[model samples]
Target: MSAPPSGPSLPKPESITASLLLGAMFNWALWGVLGCQTYLYHIYFPNDKAAFKYLIYGVFLFETAQTALNTHDTYIWFSRGFGDFLNFTKVLTSPLNTPMMGAVIALVVQLFYAHRIWTLRKSWLWFCMLLVGITLAQTGGAFYGGIRAFQAGSFVKAQTDPSNRRAVYVWLIGEAVADVLIAAAMVYLMILRRGQSHRFRSHGILARVVTITVESNCATASLAILSLIMFAGIPDTNYFTCPTIVIGKVYANTLLVSFNNRIVLRNLSQIGSPSFSSGSNIVTSSRLPLQKSTPSSAGRAFESDTITYTVHRFTETDSTTEKMDHELQETSAMKGSPSHHV
Candidate 1:
């Protein structure tokens, strides 16, 4: 019988870098998708508010920066450092790309959704505030973890330290919790709450909204949970980075897709009504116009609390408004509108 060597143990080269390399490749792939979405958003919603435009472009730029930094670090590890185990051990720029930038992007997206929740239901102000707190806490944890990892100087040290690991736990767990809450809030506010309305349920439009909200948020939350599992289960390897690095991309793409989906929604709205003129106004709001109207030349404008959108022209009649129930008037639809809380 012999005791195993007790000195610092290193993983096989294949295991050590394979996950990281694959993660970086996925990160770039998602970045490409984000770029295309950003361009499409610019073209499709030219009249979108300046603040909205700035947010979309800002996230794109942050993702671009992350991809660039990841590429530089990858080159250092595989090109310049080729065959050198020491080079592979260093933290390099990974902290910047993975937790640092990723956390900031997630925070922005979460807060954006939170604002939407507030806009939809003023009474849910407390819920929105709670979401903001969770998002901010996760971002703080991520930044703290990134700093700790960088200070550790090496993956081995970062994993071995309890404080560093705790920080990571906070970041990932908080992210998952925030994502789930956001999804649930959107579903409840935008879809389920409207279930009582006969028109919405009958048309099945609310069903589609529910699907989109759940699927998008589920994707991000699942990844965060998976990353947490990998980090906890296999502490010695970089397996967790595979999912962690792409989390930001997932968040960015989800937001962009929600924005772009408005095009589809616009088409959906026009399905039954063909009288809408050529020009379209993409309005960001919680209410979608579903109330029936009569024949008139002038178009109808769907207004919301947050952003004003000059929607397509449709006929109007007095009976449509007079016949409407007070509840229906108060509770608007979510069709052909910007995501309620994407």
Candidate 2:
């Protein structure tokens, strides 16, 4: 935690020395929080399909394993090495691999969001493909960099090498690029869809969807960019480790929040109305049931606002926009109520 150490025996840069300790601690903390979020997601959304389940659980497991590795490395450095900053054994340096694992977790989240975008806007398949490619390339570079770091005996030594810089650059830059593209694509595609139907244009549901998408990806993208800038601009100083350690949790939590918010949206759509749920299909009508109208002077307000709530049900493999639309109409017709299109 000391400033850049300067001495004949200083085997590590001051930046890396502080980063190693801080990164391990931060990763463990975030991993614990992510575990709780994952448990809640499973408990609350038990009916989610296997694909959604596997995608989330897979990322959780990966993050857990990587955190364990980081903890083990931290232990080896502090306990086995007796706080010797000069210790350069592989055990002491193994935690460098955690960034690669972080990259994997991030890529998984990106793909999940990209899939959501694909479902809503099938025309953006090419853009989603580009995101997938960038993520894969980033993971590859992260693995390559990690393996080389594994081979090197010391952390600061590897950080100082020119050959090591390329892999680091590729991984960080690729991730930063992917983060920006995914966020931009999600927001843009949602806005594009808003223009598709004049009915949907005035609906707050599209705006809500866009807001959620932006909020989720904004945190992750900001962290990615900060980490990339520090890792690339600051050189040997491991100052970037702070953001790098927590970026994975941001990705994990993004998915968790997205999943849990579905129930809230469903409830909101039915405050003064009735809705029906058949299997994975949900149909909500904005029409009120038979009741006497309240007088305007009776301290009652009658707003003609229409709220459109869309539950994409990307959790189900067979769910689609067309199917949901058809079911909405069918359900409304069954109840003899007017249908509201989302």
Candidate 3:
């Protein structure tokens, strides 16, 4: 194990000022976004699974707490100036907001996706189980690393030890693996579902659904990969942290979008054209409760159902009933009865 030098010191030499500023800004912006997205999800997708709702609420609340903690730390660092911003021991971010929490959030999101996969394709159980195992592995490693790192309170020391480095490495690499597996599995499930169901194939509903899935997971997975690479490549610098800080939020918010986008996908399918041109155009949504879409020019299927009428013929209709009704003006309607006086 490597030990840090004696006596406390400030982080003037390290250029982590940008990291702190950027991380804070990203956290704040994502939190604002998360609020709006949560509102829309509840309002529009009210019929989502109860478990899913609880998961969202849990994440929302937990992340809200995290946001508060992060903000408070930033405030103390900037306003109070009691400790150096770069000095891990002087700063008090640990035990409050750790990457382990992020790991848990990411794990929950993975489990959500795993459930989705199970529902989509039971045959994919083994794969989903693998993902769940990976999630747990990462969570364990991250929790250990975060607690240790926080306690050690020294970035230099944290990276110097093989065990410390191994813990974080396991956590980050596991997270990246989870991302890749989940995304690819989801895409595969969607494609398989459409192929199995002919109706879905003709309407291209699943096509759009696949497109959305790919779009949503692609950004997140790319970030995960990038973060993992940076963490691996540049273990000492704060560069890896730039992505690590916001990645959990990204995972949570992305899961939120994926959950809520189900309703959007259903609505879009109902109003979609029959013909679909995939990859040629993009369906964009603004960052808000409502994301507008430009109508696709694909050909639409117009179903016209015809109702047939039945006609009955009577024999000797004219001869049997020459006059169905007779006028009663003469008051001699019956052959043997006379009409009563009014």
Which candidate number would show the highest lDDT if scored against the true structure? 1
Q: Candidates ranked by TM-score, best first?
A: 1, 2, 3
Candidate 1 residue spans exceeding 4 A from truth = 1-9, 190-192, 200-205, 274-342
lDDT of 2 by residue, 194-235 (tens): 555344222344555567767877777777778778877876
Clash pairs (backbone) in predicted model 3: none
Clashing pairs in 2: none
- Kindly list the per-residue Cα lDDT of model 3 for residues 1-342, writing each as its tens digit: 889768965454344455655777898898888888899777865655676678888888888888888788667656676455454324367333657768888888778777766766778789889988998998888888877777777666666767767888788888877777776875665555554544432335455555655666676677767867776776555566667677778877887776565544433432433332223332222233333344343432222233221222334344322221111112111111111111
Query: Which prediction has more favorable lDDT, 1 or 2?
Result: 1
lDDT, model 3, position 274: 32
Winner on lDDT (1 vs 3): 1
Is 2 or 3 the stronger prediction by lDDT? 2
lDDT for model 1: 0.77
- Please list the Cα RMSD from the true structure of every candidate, rounded to 1 decimal place: 10.1, 9.3, 20.4
lDDT of each: 0.77, 0.65, 0.63
lDDT of 1 at 106: 90
